[model samples]
Target: MPQTEIQILNHLPVELLSARTEDLCDILGGPTVINLGGKRPRPLVASSLLHGNEHAGFYAVQRFLQMNIGELPRSLIWFIGNVEAAKASRRRLEHQPDYNRIWTEGPRPENKMAMKLKQFIKEQRPFAAIDIHNNTGKNPHFVNVNVLEKKFLFLAHLFSEHIVYFTEPKEIFANAISEICPSVTLECGIVGDESGVDHAYQYLNAIMHLPEIYSLTETDDIHFYESVARMMVPPDTEILWEDQAPTNPNYIQLSRQIEEDNFKDVAKGSPIATFGGDGRILVMNQKSKELTDDYLSYSGNQIQLSTDSVPSMLTSDLRVIRQDCLGYLMVRRRLEI
Candidate 1:
């Protein structure tokens, strides 16, 4: 079958127009803020498909423009990031590598596609960039606000209940987008849930009209890291976390060690957390905000504990961190071919 790329904006459906690296730069032209009359003032912008499969929000944005039409908030601008991925219904560029994992060095302005987006953002320095995606499963609706930036807390405070930080900080502040903008990544609840889609659509509506409902505030007193923690997993090992672990607003895990039965005590590489099943093992991975700090020890049995540094988002190797460091954090995949 011939592949079709879909770029739907507002209620009007546009055929996926292939961008010459130059044309894409034009499309990524930053936020076009419109000001409608309101007692308070704020800018709300939304974009989706930083990764392809996590496409629920893109549809939500589409539904939003359809229903609201001329009624959309004056200051709100709806955006679509991975025009290429969304068009193909896949995650990243097929021939090209994942975009989300890259951000260390800026995308070459001369590069066909990246330059287009670079120019767009350069032209429109939005107040915030609300990227949307789906979580791995059907869990409670959640939001990821990269914690390093102070502006992220505003989102946590504004949304309160649904916020989930990707860091060890127990507070609502630790989100990947926190550094980039007062941004939020809406995990609109399991990818396939239509209700999740509907609910997210409502939230999008609420955000566009944010100034109407909540008072706006700003602060610069926030914690950001120069160096990041990296996770280096040895071969043949799997890792998992409790779903509720990130539920707390201020919870941070410093060091975690896994106790598995695969290794022997008398010999090398003792078991840490067992992989799969009951009583298999216990595990622990250290979580520390400051990279220079030492991990606190738990006074129990010795498990196979390793402290993996948090990967830098700015690396050529995208495997280091879980969140998008630059641009919009997206699902890590491709749609082309």
Candidate 2:
């Protein structure tokens, strides 16, 4: 289908931000952009709810707006995404593509909306960009950047000490907007957490008043990690393993608990899962190149990592496991300072 016209609002609707995220579809219809004037000239692009299930970004934006009812510290290009999906409280509707993945040129309505947004943002030439989200599992609030520049590092460190850098999965909001200015993605932990909402609001507020985003200093204490590989599980419908499918020869039982060990340093050959069926986990790197044979090993009935590494975002939610990814394998990188 051809792309249709998108909605862009110049002013806030009465009590729009106050509405629950799940109720947004009734007001905004679909993906919408709300551009508001601020004391500063260059706008700060804030995108949230790209995944419908995440609520931190929506509430944080609301809180920020509530505190500064009359005016904002800086110009804001607020992008509210996945409203239809939000109504259903899922990452995305079954028919719709992931909002974050359609920023590149494409034929989908979401893709066209993204292109329209990109053009508008380019015209504004914003100071910086922020795309906020919540983790489906238990994890620390961290920042993610696609680029390795000092300015990006400085911007990310302002939000949290833990930072992740990934280069693959192109056309995501932060990576795409980084072409115009510095951009960062915030993974504020857990949906509906008050602290998570506050953390995001504080970070957004701080950036609103930033005098300048120059470079990271040696004094900045930030723990940075680079994702080496992503662990992908089979679609839930395709293969039901272990817990769901015992007789089906398609899955092995994961040995370790999913949530607790996130970001824990594990030695090479640490047991990951026990053999059960003929299924194999897909392991891909930052380049989107598969490295299953290169990074995984099996000892007896156990599947193990080929090298010592840290993992993050290991989710126990079966729905997320099927929709997104199991988690990522990472290695810590020292700051050049």
Candidate 3:
């Protein structure tokens, strides 16, 4: 079967702007790239809903455009991705590849749409790029970048002072777009938080008028962390949380408040989770090495932190945990400036 190409529109589907995120599929039919002209020629490419369950970006972008109407300060190429997954409120369908990860150079059908979207932004010579998202866990608003460059750091600081620089997930949209322009991913807290929507809307409005992104100066108050490892769970291991404990040996039992550990300066020997049997939580570095014991202490059926560092994106959602990751382990680092 031939893959679906992204739908390209030169103007906003203003009539469908009010459509709920889940209902976008019926209108857009699939992934879409909308290019709207502004006072400036070079566009600012902003993408949203790469993960269908993340709706803050979608709504924020829509609201920002609606408010601007015909007074945009800069051209924009906003790609609304994963509408199919949005229809069912899933991150991605079982048979579908992650939309965000497909933007890297690849030959998959989804990558075709991503590459097409990339081509659109590349043609615009965008001054900056932003991919908006919402966490499934209790996480403060923050930004993520793939590079340690000043422009990327400053671009991220515009959204939040808490910035994470990661290189391992090199194929994600932000990472790929960084090569073309300064790019950052906005983690706008969790879904259904209006503050997140407000922040994202404010961000969109600010970026529409940005002059030169590369020279923007931010404060020394920024909190920077380098993502060094990913935390994962075995596929067959069942997750038990929120007052539920393992009745079987295949389950990993954790506190419902495990997500509260996100962004905290966790001390060594901090409890993470308890295994049902002899199994352990998996922690892997950027090279995909299994250094679980180096980062975690697992004995007596409990998993504890062996390193003093900050953890981010900790989620209790079992599907997200299995599909993507339990969370990421990060270490504090300073940019040379």
Q: Write the per-residue lDDT of candidate 1 for residues 1-337, one digit (tens) a residue.
A: 1112222233332321223212332454421222232223344656555556566766776676667655556445454555455445556655644545433234432133333433443344445656667644224555565543445546544443434344433222113234435676666655567876787788777667655333224433322122223223232223334222333332222122211211111122322222322111222222422322231122232333233221112221223213321111112111111
Q: CA lDDT of 17 in candidate 1?
A: 27
Candidate 2 clash figure, as a count: 0
Q: What lDDT does each candidate get?
A: 0.41, 0.82, 0.85
**TM-score ranking of the models:** 3, 2, 1
Arrange candidates, best lDDT first: 3, 2, 1
TM-score between candidate 2 and the true structure:
0.92
Using Cα atoms with residue i matched to residue i, what is each candidate's TM-score against the true structure? 0.51, 0.92, 0.92
Q: Say which prediction, candidate 2 or candidate 3, comes out ahead on TM-score.
A: 3
Lowest summed lDDT over 10 consecutive residues: which window, candidate 3? 1-10
Better of 1 and 3 by TM-score: 3
Whole-model lDDT, model 2: 0.82
Q: Candidate 1: misplaced stretches above 4 Å?
A: 1-43, 107-119, 147-151, 157-162, 166-181, 212-337
- Candidate 2 Cα outliers beyond 4 Å, as residue runs: 1-4, 235-245, 286-288
Please give the RMSD to the true structure for each candidate, in Å.
Answer: 13.0, 2.6, 2.2
Q: State the RMSD for candidate 1.
A: 13.0
Error of 3 at 270 (Å): 2.0
